[model samples]
Target: MANVTKLRCNETVRIEQARIVALYAQLGQQAAERLMASAIEDLAMHMVAIDAAVQKNQLGAFDDAVTSLIPLARQVGMTKLEQVTRDLRDCMRAQDLVASRAVLARLMRIGDRSLSEVWDLEDMSI
Candidate 1:
């Protein structure tokens, strides 16, 4: 009998709470909420593009999509998500499909959780 060990990758998602608070303070609650929602939507839309590129084996498209996502993530202080995003970009740039697959999975996980973390703050008083 052969043994198969599954890899469960649960990464820690670090949200810069102070950055978010500063945003709310600078822009006020109403404006910050709107911007946050829009940014989240933008992130989700680009993540879809990245997934589609990965599925279709289009490295150039994947790289471009990931490149665009980097700044948006940093702006919101999603430290872990941004770091993973950069890692994925490096993988794609190296033309390393094997590494890209694993990195892509991590990026997606961090991305989704980061979005939720920001979205959840929409109603909370920072």
Candidate 2:
């Protein structure tokens, strides 16, 4: 989370490429890009909340930050970040491991939502 905040636009774009690779493995390149866009859109909603919290210097704003970031993380195959955010939230509430695991499981659900699967690894035998 802090790492994301530290990254510049170009760095973010590079990380974005990693996400593209993840989505492409399950769907195809085009579908993966589209999914990335959609995920970005979803994350934007939570970003709004995060921005608000950061402006106020309030630790309580972490909820909004996590909420905003997870959708984007899930979209980009960043299951770990999504899990960490979920873990923090659940622990903050009542220290529930089951809930955290469930949240992680939901992150994996993105693969199931893919429309198709294709790969351009055919002509690479050379």
Candidate 3:
């Protein structure tokens, strides 16, 4: 069961490149580019909110941050970020502060990596 959970987590952490490609195909290059930029901004804002929530040990704020992150992360093909945010939300729901803290750290790392991956894709003209 643990292995299965790990496998699922690994899968969620990866960006769905096909989704991004399909967005570009459907929206056209300029519109897709703008949407990506907006999504990145939203992600950054939410990250800041999450960081603040964690620092203050405010679960409500953390929950709010995660809530805002899910759809935006999905829209941007940030599957890992979306998944980790969900994990954090669940930890909060369970009132597991220790687990929530650990998940928060993981979220920061994955969020950074996912954003960089998207930037790299953009650089490659993907």
For this target, which candidate reaches the highest lDDT against the unseen true structure? 3
For residues 36-125, write the lDDT of model 2, one tens digit per residue: 567655654554554454344444775667766877666665564455456646654564556644543443332222211112221222
TM-score of 1: 0.90
Ranking by lDDT: 3, 1, 2
RMSD, each candidate, Å? 1.5, 11.7, 5.8
How does residue 93 of candidate 2 score in lDDT?
Answer: 59
> Taking the tens digit of each residue's C-alpha lDDT, what string does model 3 give over 1-126?
355443333322567889899999999999999998888888989998998897788878877888899999998888778888899888878888899888988888889888888887888777
| Native-to-model Cα distance after best TM-score fit, residue 116 in candidate 3, in Å | 0.4
Q: Note the residue pairs that clash in candidate 2.
A: 46-68
Q: The CA-based lDDT of model 2 is what?
A: 0.49
Position 12, candidate 1: lDDT: 70
Candidate 1 lDDT over residue span 93-114, tens digit each? 7888899888889889999998
lDDT of model 1, residue 42: 88
- TM-score of candidate 2 on Cα atoms, chains taken together: 0.39
Global lDDT scores for all candidate models: 0.84, 0.49, 0.84
